[model samples]
Target: MPGLGEIIRESQIWKSIFRHPMPLDRRNRIVVMLTNFFLHLHPVSIKKQGIALSYTWCMGGVTFFLFLVETVTGVLLMFYYRPTVEWAYTDIQMLRDVHSLGILREIHRWGAHAMVITVWLHMYRVFLTGSYKPPREFNWVIGVFLLLLTLLLSFTGYLLPWDQLAVWAITVGSNMARATPILGHEGPGQQLLTLGGVDMITNASDARFALLGAREVGEETLNRFYILHCIAIPLAVALLLAIHFWRVRKDGGISGPL
Candidate 1:
């Protein structure tokens, strides 16, 4: 037993593999306490009954479960999707036309809708519970941003089908971007485009250009939207999502009454 102990104690490989501190050691506490990046992310201990099933369940764990489900199903959908306009609409149609396509699409669509609802409810719960005071205020801001990103993600993806609804919805959604003020990207960029002799600045470079991938809503536009829908927006969302979770841990794992 002593020989075994020595081997375990001296094993650098073991230390590297098991980086987490020993569960109850005071020495481990000091190590965690001194680590800046992770130090403030967790309390030293928790009450035995603090995380009761009722308290935890009342919040939105189900919503997070839906997010994971969407992630898995989305990845599967990726395999069947191509970003080109020619293929994008077709792929979506195929999802419906094929035997299981209907099931997959509904699960993905409904899952997205449910995720939005659940996230909102989650924030509401946190607010009602008075969890956004002081140290957690910054995290609350981050959560709000995440909620917006989630909605944007849904909106941006809506146009992939190239159907009447998708086209019109994005057509309207993007028009709002056009009307935003100079600092909002309309005034300054628009004036610059006009000076450059781009007759239809909308055709040359604008919200439509960015969204459609070309001057107008043709093949190129769909392709661009597909890229944003599948890749760019998701990456941005994921990065912010990481920060959101990290801030939660840092802010003492949700606030309580002072």
Candidate 2:
């Protein structure tokens, strides 16, 4: 039998995984990188002095990691939750009372809230460092979209609890949607929805009806929101997130000292 070293060296699968066809110079750069975990974060090494060790509040990557954690925990929480008015609030209590971890939902809930704050802070940090310049501009735009998706995910989630807070907040929010330019009363966008003869500005046909599942916020609204919260929003966030991460790699990573 071949020695252990020979077996690993000759394994076609291992070779494929580790193979790189770069020029010698390019290959050496990659080798030096794969040899260290922390240095792998950069596209190229720089003088340690070049890093603004004191000024860089670089936590955007950390925020993204935390967002992933919240997404995973949120899905797990949904498995044990019901969004119907009758049981929705009770389910939250039950998840806490009877969930396998005893506090799984609590952790997920707070983690979600924390993610919102951290993402905002991450954006603020980038703005402070002037990282929004040049080639990084497009990445910033993508980051903004991810930020909005995070907020949407949070808003959809707030309704799943089906408590007084959830209902009233969604009611206020849907009204704000109705007030939007194309869709709201204030904009030219409302004209198309009037059905030529019938009026849409009226509550009967306005955007609020579909969103609230009735003329006013109630049970069915909560149910529809539950599906959106657990499935639709999560999927959108995932796709945008993949783009967000890919942009980081394409943009040459966090802006470093000149």
TM-score of each model, in listed order: 0.71, 0.76
lDDT for each residue of candidate 1 in 15-116, tens digit (9 for 90 to 100): 775565553688777666555464554455665444665444444557657767777788888788776767877888888897475577779889888888
How far out, in Å, is residue 67 in model 1?
2.5
Report the C-alpha displacement of residue 181, candidate 1, in angstroms.
1.5
Q: What is the Å distance of residue 175 in model 2 from its true position? A: 2.0
Error of 1 at 72 (Å): 1.3
For each of the candidates, the C-alpha root-mean-square deviation to the true structure, in angstroms, is: 6.0, 5.0
Error of 1 at 44 (Å): 9.1
The lowest-lDDT stretch of 10 consecutive residues in candidate 2 is 49-58
- What are the runs in model 1 whose C-alpha is more than 4 Å off? 1-60, 99-102, 183-203
Q: Which residue pairs show collisions in model 1?
A: 212-221
Best candidate (score: TM-score): 2
Cα-based lDDT for every prediction: 0.70, 0.74
| Model 2 pairs in collision | none
